[model samples]
Target chain A: MTDNMYIERSCRISENTIWLDGAPYWKGLPAASFIDFAKEAFRLLKVDYPKFYKMDNLSKLVFLAADFLLQQQDKDGIALVMANRSSSLDTDIKHQQSIQEKESFFPSPATFVYTLPNICEGELCIRHQLMTENIFLVDECFPTETIEMYAAYLLRSGKAKRVMCGWAELFQENYDAVLYLVGPNGEKEHTKKNIEDLFR
Target chain B: MVELKEELKGKIIEVLNLEDVTVGDIQDGDALFGDGLGLDSIDALELIVLLDKEYGIKLSDPKQGKAIFKSIETMAAYISENRTK
Candidate 1:
């Protein structure tokens, strides 16, 4: 009944944890203080966290998910459709708060870069060399059927033989990820409807 | 002095995420860039931050860091000369 689903490779969360370390539970989350928020994602995904260089928190999610998918996906070109309530609202707030007092205003180069939500997609494309369609939507929650339908259309139309489609959401400390490998259902007529019904 | 250089090597390997490098892997005058350790610009920026945080030196210009960071030897020399703390 609710179109509250999306695919995900990973969902990097805030260190402002509100629940146990394992289960996906939630409460209000404090604003992320530094790029350290990425450490949460890396710890969950079990990737060796890079020691230095400045890839802010948002880039961390995009880069890690992209790397994971690239290694595992057998595809041609990449088509991505992702949903978010709003793009980088927390980062935008922090950036504005920084420059509010010109004397103390330090536009934190790190925070400023993530003010646009689509940057995550761009970061992935750059990392994986994906040159294809990427659409970022702002929705209160994920739109499930539309997500699969669109991803299917791309695959069926031969735009991409395989698509890494899903929802990667980070709201406060709550995070959710569902990444799917969509194609012409091997051997059997593994209809797209079956794939779409996965959430059901 | 030798202890400091060795410490610097360990920090460099740790900070750059240089997965295949080690203290013995790094020689006193071994080149750190362009084929020796294969570090690039992003690694350079990390080293700049390291200079500020660990050695009390600030390198605002990336170009100026070339000779100063030619190797662990050059880095220690510059740090010994310019470090404020």
Candidate 2:
């Protein structure tokens, strides 16, 4: 039954550009930093959520990708299975720096809240009001096969009506986010090869 | 008190990362939380840390924040009264 699942849509953010469903959607400034790019993309997308401005870089990346994929679509009962390579190291370093110096030791709640990789997933859930099964994994690579298997299992087991799976990695200036929506119907089959092709 | 209010407004904007908000946007009587600036609990904690690090005022009681963080005016008044720095 899970084999019947298909890739409905995909969104990617990399190289200061945003791609939606295998097409270039937005191109940011050449020298824009990750935060700058995110803000620009958010504005270009006309996102009205004010909470978006307060998110850390990792959460912002994931939020932007999810925003592209999930906009104008039914958000109910959609599970999220995401993985990343950095595991929130970008914000972890900032939090560590905030406390490393005894003279300036002030760990902020905003920064402390995003030290875990799964916090990005939590941010997405908050933005979209998703109250379904969700998981965030940390791996050295994208773990394409694992994400496919897990998302397919969720659909086949009736755990979720739809699943959003992807990789969101951000450490320092480097950031990459690739998210795809999987459901019972779509033009592309939800196979490992098709997921890999979309990622590439 | 006017000078302190402006300073607190600037500090709040900087500490809370209110990118879309400016010092001019926040009025002296504007509510810091729901309905006005729309700051959440996390912003409240940031303001607490701001008070401690900048004004040397440690908020020992969490309930005090509800009243103290009501507006820029209230925060400045509290800081003026209790600031050890």
Candidate whose lDDT is highest: 2
Residue-pair clash count for candidate 2: 0
lDDT of the structure predicted as candidate 1:
0.62
Runs with alpha carbons beyond 4 Å of true place in candidate 1: A1-73, A84-128, A145-159, A170-174, A186-200, B19-21
TM-score of each: 0.59, 0.97
lDDT of 1 by residue, A1-200 (tens): 12223332232233443222123433233575334444443455465433323454445555555554555555467677776665677568777997798655445544566788777777767656778888877777667667767776776666765566655565444454444455543332324554444333
Off by over 4 Å in 2: none
The residue pairs in collision within model 2 are none
Model 1 TM? 0.59
The whole-model lDDT of each prediction reads 0.62, 0.91
Clash counts for all predictions = 5, 0
Listed per model, the TM-scores of chain A against the true chain A are 0.66, 0.97
Give the proportion of true interface contacts each model preserves, from 0 to 1.
0.00, 0.79
Model 1 pairs in collision: A7-A166, A7-A167, A7-A178, A8-A178, A8-A179
